[model samples]
Target: MAEKAEDTGVIAWLVETVKTVFWALVIAGIFRTVLFQPFWIPSGSMKDTLLIGDFLFVNKMAYGYSYASCPSIRIARLGVDIGADDFCGFIEDREERFFGADPERGDIVVFRHPVDGRDFIKRLIGVPGDRIQMQDGLLYINDAPVQVAPVGTFDEVWERQGPLGNTPSCSNGPVGPGSICQKERFIETLPNGVSHAILNVGDRPGDNTGVFTVPEGQFFFMGDNRDNSVDSRFLQANRGVGFVERKDIVGRADRVMFSSAGRSMFAFWTWRSDRFFKALD
Candidate 1:
């Protein structure tokens, strides 16, 4: 009788364990299939905007369901009915939920890289049907030059490697100073609505020429750190970063949750006290 009772207790514990595991799996599946996800900043592609150690929350719902899993594929039949399957992903979704009414100009968007499908974040510069060009290190959107007003001082506001005048992105033209990162700044505007800041690091052979067209359902993006960035210019030169699909946008940078800088070995741990609670443009 004693042995039987012990065996019964062990069986009950096993049953409870299985139930707990099942529920956990179900909850995880729901979260992954819906709601928001997280992404870490791995590189300096959008240097001045997103830093290397910053951790961000990606709003998957911002653009609706993008990665639905299934085995079936849709293929067009040739003059007769037939089971369809092909290398191209053309299966019609049973249910569709549209997200993001439209991507705003200058909106910082996170997207799947067209070249390799890795997630990338960049600001929208050109939209469908717009012609873009670069002139004398300055950007020209649809024949109108962008306006960049001098706002305080980037060097004073942000902690670069050196003093206010020595930012690498500022070392050319009217402000060109080898002694400092002398370059000009501007506020750029794109057609169909978007405006943002641009940092020109001056006369790098890479920034002087290019005429681009933005196709429907695609956008042209670039980083603010002009000379220091690998953006639509480089992406298009290689013909890889040409167009970012609308469905790829993750979400806008709503706010700057935190910022830390200076000469501390643990820069993250050394928080910028005043800069805390500051909003991102």
Candidate 2:
């Protein structure tokens, strides 16, 4: 009788623990699906504005949650690639819940890469029906030149040693040692009165692009690191992310929750304390 009682008690405790864990996961899933999702910056394309190692929370409700907005596990269970171009089936049939607003020009958005379906974050430069062009590194929207004010020069050199292979040199980066790269920085103010810093590495091919008309229900995005980014200026056929459809956008990046300058998360000395909780313009 004593043995049976002990076994019963143990089973009861196990059952209770399982129930607690299950409920916790459920609550977490709900929070992640309805509120915000975390993302880490992996590239320097948005340099100076958003840096590599910057971790931010994307506000999913900023532009509403579509079918692609479902949590990854749920999406996986559905047996579909949520990042695919046709994940939402049809552009006209895309469904969103709690639709509160639309993304504005100058907003940094996280969206599915139009070609490969990878998640990418960039500043929304053109809305539907907007004409965008870059000439000699100057940006023009609807034939009006956007204001570009010189900020200063950005110089940095860094080394990356990790599982991905050792990168001994980096340009305009936070890495340590080696060849230092200098780039001109400028403040670009959009027509909507939103201003942010942009890096210019002289003139590149992207600096002289033909006029691009944003189609209905599509948006043009660009990286702050003008010369280095492969954004809407290039075509998808050329391995560049072209115009992103509205249904592909995941959310808006509102702020930097945390940032690190070191190679490892455990490196306390490399923490960028000043960038913590920094709001994106």
Q: What CA RMSD would you report for each candidate?
A: 9.7, 4.1
**Candidate 2 lDDT, 1-281, residue by residue in tens:** 99999999999999999999999998987787678877878777888898778889989988986754554421455676544334434442463334746799999999877666677899999999999999899999999999999977876664553223234223354434666667888999999999999988765799888999999878999999898787999999999988888877889999999988777757778889999999998
* TM-score of model 2 (CA atoms): 0.87
TM-score of candidate 1 relative to the true fold: 0.67
Per-residue lDDT of model 1, residues 1-281, tens digit only: 99999999999999999999999977865664465445444454555566544555555555564442111122335443221122113632222335545566777767756544455777878887878777877777777766655543233222243112223444433333324433355665555445556655556765776788888877888777677666676664574467766654545554444544433326655565554444445
Relative to the true structure, candidate 1 has a C-alpha RMSD (angstroms) of 9.7
Q: Estimate the TM-score of every prediction.
A: 0.67, 0.87
- Candidate 2: residue 263 lDDT (0-100): 76
Each model's lDDT comes to: 0.56, 0.80
